[model samples]
Target: MASMDVSLKEMMAIDGAVGAVVVDYNSGMALGSLGGSKDLDLQIAAAGNTEVVKAKLRTMESLGLKDTIEDILITLNTQYHIIRPLTGRSGKGLFLYLALDRARGNLALARHNMRIIEEKLEV
Candidate 1:
């Protein structure tokens, strides 16, 4: 299993990755983070995205959907934001967030790689 630092570093290795973080949705805190520019603050982003995750989870419950979220994607004109909730016992209430440059990133491959990282992450 990969350590949190190792997992976050792996995330930044993805093509176009500008920033990455492992956040605890329950507390809106980042356990580990890597790569962020002046334009992108990983701490603030982590806290703000906690609300996004919580909202989707509530919406799913309200809709009576007995399902789990594979990932959440937010696309901007210049970037793609991917939020992946971790399902492993040690990773409950946590998620991995990645920011990618739209022009340089491959969405399909990023998602696949994130899944693999999530699986190997040891929290």
Candidate 2:
């Protein structure tokens, strides 16, 4: 399995990738982050995304849906944000967030790669 650093590095290698981070939704704190700056602040993004994850989790509970979120995708005018909660029991409460250039990214492939990355992440 890959370590957090390796995993984040691997994520950055994806085509069109701009930034990636592993965050804690409960505390809205990013434990690890790579890329994004100047106009894009990853810490702020991570905190905001914590709310997004919480809202989705709450909605799922209310609906009594037994499905877990594979990933949350937000399509913006110029970028696509992918939020993936680590499924490994050891990594519960943590999530992987990836930002990509919508015009340069292949959504399907990126999702697949993200899954692979999650599966291999050691933490």
Candidate 3:
């Protein structure tokens, strides 16, 4: 298991990582962040993604789906944005957001690594 800082640092080690953050879905704020270029403002991305999380949760509720979101993926022309909600009881309402360069990232490996990171993250 890893603490927030450790987890964030580890996430940054992923191949093609452009940025990563732990965000509060309810408040749309970043609890921690790392590796953002000038063009990628992680805080703003976190806030915008808060809506995406909320919308999906709302939709799931409306549809009466018992399933929860494992993760959310947004594929852009040049980037891959991944949103993974924290699952621990203490981690409710928080998520991990990662941005990667599609050409340089291995989507499968990144997703698998993110899952491990999420499991080990200490809220």
Candidate 4:
């Protein structure tokens, strides 16, 4: 199993990856991060994304959907943002955020790899 540091590093290696962070959804704080440029404040992004996760959870509860969220994809004009909540026992309350250049990213492959990383991540 990979440690959190290793997982974040591996995420940064993905094609078109611009930023990556492991965040606490409950607190909206990044536990770890890498690859964000000055233009991208990953800390702020992490906090904002926490709200997104919370909103989805509230929606799911209201809908009576017992299923867990796999991931949330937000496609912007030039970028693709992926928010994946960690499901492992030790990873509860945490999530991973990945930003990719839309033109260069392979969304399917990225999602697949993120799942793998999440599975192996050692909280």
Q: What total of clashing residue pairs does each candidate reach?
A: 0, 0, 0, 0
Candidate 4 structure quality by residue, lDDT tens digits, 12-93: 9999999999999999999999988887899999999999999999999999999999999999998999999999999999
Candidate 1, lDDT over the whole model:
0.97
On lDDT, the leading prediction is: 1
The pairs that clash in candidate 4 are none
Task: Enumerate residue pairs that collide in model 3.
Answer: none
The candidate, 1 or 3, that scores higher on lDDT is 1
How displaced is residue 67 in candidate 4, in Å?
Answer: 0.5
Better of 1 and 2 by TM-score: 1
- Local error of candidate 4 at residue 36 (angstroms): 0.9
TM-score of 3: 0.98
RMSD of 4: 0.6
TM-score of 1: 0.99
Clashes of 4: 0
TM-score of each prediction: 0.99, 0.97, 0.98, 0.98
- Which digits, one per residue and each the tens of the lDDT, describe model 3 over residues 33-95? 999988999999999999999999999999999998999999999999999999998899999
lDDT of 3: 0.94
What are the candidates' C-alpha RMSDs?
A: 0.5, 0.7, 0.6, 0.6
